[model samples]
Target: MTSFILFAALLIVAVIAILLPPLLRAPKPSTGADHREANLAIFRDQLAELERERENGSLALADFEQAQNELQRRLLDEVQPAASAPSETRPGRKTALALLVVLPLAAAGGYALLGNQQALDPLQRQARITPQQIEGMVAGLVEKLKENPDDSKGWLMLARSYKVLERFPQAAEAYGRAGALVDQNPELLADYAEVLSRSQGGDLQGKPTELVERALKIDPNEPQALLLAGAAASDRQQFALAADYWARLLAQIEPGSEEAKALAAAVERARAIAAQGAAAAPAGQTAVANGSAVSGEVTLSGEVAGQASPDDVLFVFARPDEGPRMPLAATRARVGDLPLRFRFDDSMALAGGKKLSDFKTVSIEARVAKAGKAQSSSGDLFGTLSGVKPGSQGLRLLIDQVQP
Candidate 1:
């Protein structure tokens, strides 16, 4: 406010400085100095002509004198006394003063009508809106949305704001509105799916999962959709599918982001679970192919063994040594079962016609998670051995590396 007042004062002063001279200047005097000066010039010229006439004998000395006296009399008659000369009429000072007043007022009125005064205020737009004020604003928007249901972008923004505030139900409603307006928009679909999941206690199996799938169909690499899809698959115990979805998401995300790091662990854990499921074949199925069976025992390192609880999950798996490093076979056991024996063969394959025997060389890995979840999180212990040939016998795996 103080700054504004100062600016206004300075502006008025500058306007006055520019206009005052023309408005308040003293009227100049209208003297007869021009008339008196003209008469004196005529008299001098007449005297010069008279002297020339006498020298040329065009007139006698007496005639030149007489002409000079006549010229003097004429000059006296033309010249007026300064005290009796009339002063020219000066323009009214009142008009100039009126112009001075009108110009500033017009300028000020024009600015008031057309200038954006709010732009000069640094906090006028958003900075002054506090959290509580924001909530009120959101409420106002909600009311507006109720009145006008066709504002798609408004609904989207409202949904996002509600999501930030953890008002999942309201967010879901707004997201629905936005999604309805722009079907097949990947970001909207994914956000709507996520909000719907949250509103329903984080259950992604039904409509939420369907929404994510739809979003992915529109944009195969949409990161949020891929993540939700992976989570949904994991919830359904389709660990391989979950891993594949997360891997695609990981490739598109910033590699150094916290999300990517967490996701990398998730992919690893999924592969481990998938491997385990494959290796532990359904009842009545033939044991994994014997031709390429890899048998190994996982033991916890003494240095980190104390961190595990009996209920903690342990994952052991084998992946391709060369290309498309998805797990071929895997199995899970409790940490209490560490130093336990495990085997991988065709029965443990992720899908039919794919098995440990498909690759001559393979990599083996083991991870221990305290949460008992398949996806690895922070503090999980893991270790790996690369370039191992299939059917290797009596191999010993150690769980040593710690996920940071």
Candidate 2:
């Protein structure tokens, strides 16, 4: 709107500049100078003719003198000044005023008819795809797919496009078709798992975990597969396994890159949690107890250590690999008791059927519970280690990041 007003004002100023000179100019006065000059020249010419006639004996001297006087009188009549007259500028002023109103209106009307006002709107000027354009593109792809249903690359492209457009169900379907045609290519499998996970509210376990495992089987070092597997492990409270997967992925990427750094940090955190689980074994049970005991040391990170209270509860425990997420072996201690050593075995099981020895693998988590709750909650500082075999020892867990 501001830009529109500025352009209109500029147009008005330009019109005024073009028309002002004629409107404001003074009327020229007539002083008879041109008439006087014309009369003098005529008089001189007649006098010369009369003299020539006299010399040629074509006229009498008195007649020539009379003609000369007549010419002189006419010249004198022309040269005499006339009375002054008033100059009326009212008509010109009225015309100027009318034009001042009409020109601007005309220019504005013309611009309204020919110009695109939206062009001046910076937000509108940026090109963006509309819903209709997206629909058209999708229709085109559908038609192409109908004609070439077995084209793996086409299906892959369509799947990616659907993912970008946030049509997760369609993307998953397309990815499935592509994967089938391509014999479950590792990259496609990974992408399929990702979109499927997104469709399921980001739960990467169950089917998504299976897909990730399949991708890993095809190419164990595949970055996406490793990343997905690590995320799944972390979500399942298996920080140790997550660390292993991310560490493998980290080795494949360029060092010092943001992804590599993030993976390295995650690896360190997972290792810290694993160490804490190892320390969770009982005081006198440093040696293996039923082959499922986990022993480790738990401590807070530097950032959290200073602000943490000595009375804060630290919960360290192990959970079954595939059964319920409830802790299988657990213990609690105060923050002041850390860098406190911990030990956990089947004797600490919350339920008899959920013991660590019952599972082939287990996960360990250590949380600093400011709220003093046994169950993890928001704002609790925690770390985890996953996929530990029974009787792991000498692990270290650092309670660094907070639960969101």
Candidate 3:
């Protein structure tokens, strides 16, 4: 700010220096002075003519004297008024002084009224809004929405705001109120699906999956929709479909970016799972595919069993002991079916080309979800048995730990 002010002061000084001198200097004499000088020169010429006329005997001495006297009288009359006239340059000097005072003040006043004074303040430029302020703004928006319930655009904006705040339920409600506005917009549909899934404890089944499908139909290349669709497919154990969706998403992303690298890794995993499943398809005809089926009993321990509701989902799955975490075989039930007998084989493989027979050893897990979701979350009961052979039988898997 100091530097800016110094530069502005210097510029003002330079402008004043350029303009003031011309205004302050004394002005040239007026046309009356020129007229007086012209008249004297004329008088001198006439006097010389009169002298020549008398010397040549063309005029008498008396005539020559009279003519010279007349010329001298005229010259005196012209010179007297001009000599008595007051100087006109004083007023110009006064105007220059007035301008010297007014110009800088006018410039400063105009800038104060119109310029951005806070631009030079780094703190003001970098200031961030507090969370309380954001909440207040959202509250105001909510009040406005209540008064104008038919405002679809407002509802969409409110939905996005709620999503940013991680208030999933409110975001879902706002998206629903957005009516037809969100229905045709692929991005909004994807966002709505995401928030709806989040609101339901991250289960993308049923409506959330349907919303994602709708977004994909509208714009097959929509990135978020493809991502969500891939996740939904992966959750359903359709690894081939998941791979396809992610590959499509990958095509739209810039290569060599972090996001692209992560996505590429996911696509490869899904494709590998799909390839394994495909390889196992022919072996599905056998009862155990060379004794690859693993038989087990899943039981919830008494300590965490009481914490699970009857309708909560139960997932039993096996992953390779040393490779990617994608499940090779899986089965689902409910908490009410605890202490149930379970079997996983090539037939139960979730992906087209992956099977339990492929792994020499695997890790089996059982999770009782409180929210009926496949993915474990806080308060879910789960247990893991590692280094178990695929063809192992009569294994007892206990749900002993509570996810935090």
Candidate 4:
């Protein structure tokens, strides 16, 4: 900052120096004697021209005399007494002094009004803002928005602030208020969908899914939209659609980047699932129609069995060995049903167009959910056996570990 001020001072000094000389120098004065002499010379030329006109018979003798007298009278009228000319040097000096004072002040004042004074201050530029300060600012914005509800930009800013604070419900409400502002913007739509999904316990169904789809339609390569769309398709067991969405997303990322590598891996998994589905379509259909079953016994391990309650829901499911983690087939029971026989079949598929016979190898899992939710949560007891075939029977599955 000191260096910048010094440099600016030097520039102002240079500008003043360049202008001072021109302003200070007095203008050449027109003296009375010089003016009278010039008038006499003009009178002489006029008299000579009158004589020539008379000799050429263009003027009468009386007319020639009148013309010469008129010329003399005009010269006399133009001439002034040769007196000392008033000094202009004083005015010039005053103007120079005024410029020296006013120019620097004007320049400084203009810069103070328009320039970024804090630009060179490193401390000011690098100051860290605390989370509390940010929240205060957001609160201020919210109050301002209340006073001016038509401010769409303010609403959008508030929405983003709420999202950053993980206040998802409030964020969704603010995004809704953003209204038409979010409709045309793909990034805004994607962010709105994310917040809305978070508000719904991370379920990107219904309105969130619709928003994701709308965002994708506007910009096919919108990264967040594509991610949400792919996840939604995977949740629906539409592996081919998920693969297509993820592949498009992968194409948009820079090669060799970590994000690109991760997306590429996801795309590959989705494609593997889609390929497996294609290969098993006919057999899976037939198996579902024929009611083929994979019967097994689920027994809780003595080591972890003490954690289970009699009424805790037990979920037994089968998923393909490769690709998305969605269940192909599942059955529900209670913790009291431990050491119970379970009949898993294509008929118990979790989603349409997917069946127990849809993969070469399937993994069977049994989870005792204390919260009675299908998804595994903390404190759940679970176990798994991989490489089980669709018609495998008399298999013993153990519920061994506690979900962390």
On a 0 to 1 TM-score scale, where does candidate 4 land against the true structure? 0.42
Query: How well does each candidate superpose onto the true structure, as a TM-score?
Result: 0.42, 0.42, 0.46, 0.42
Task: Point to the candidate with the largest TM-score.
Answer: 3
In angstroms, give how far residue 47 of model 2 lies from its true place: 3.6
Writing each residue's lDDT as its tens digit, candidate 3 over 335-390 gives 88878897776655543246888888999999886755555679888999999997
Q: Is candidate 3 or candidate 4 better by lDDT?
A: 3
Candidates arranged by lDDT, highest first: 3, 4, 1, 2
Candidate 2 segments exceeding 4 Å error = 1-46, 54-114, 130-133, 179-189, 210-227, 244-272, 280-404
Per-residue accuracy of model 2 over 212-267 as CA lDDT, tens digit each: 88787677666888799889877866665666567656655565789867877888
Winner by lDDT: 3
> Please, what is the whole-model Cα lDDT of each candidate in the order they appear?
0.77, 0.76, 0.81, 0.80
State how far residue 336 of model 1 sits from its true place (Å): 36
State, as a TM-score between 0 and 1, how close model 1 is to the true structure: 0.42
The global Cα lDDT (0 to 1) of model 4 is 0.80
Instruction: Tell me how many clashing residue pairs each candidate has.
Output: 8, 24, 8, 0
| Global Cα RMSD, each model | 14.2, 12.6, 18.1, 20.0
The CA lDDT at 253 in model 2 is 59
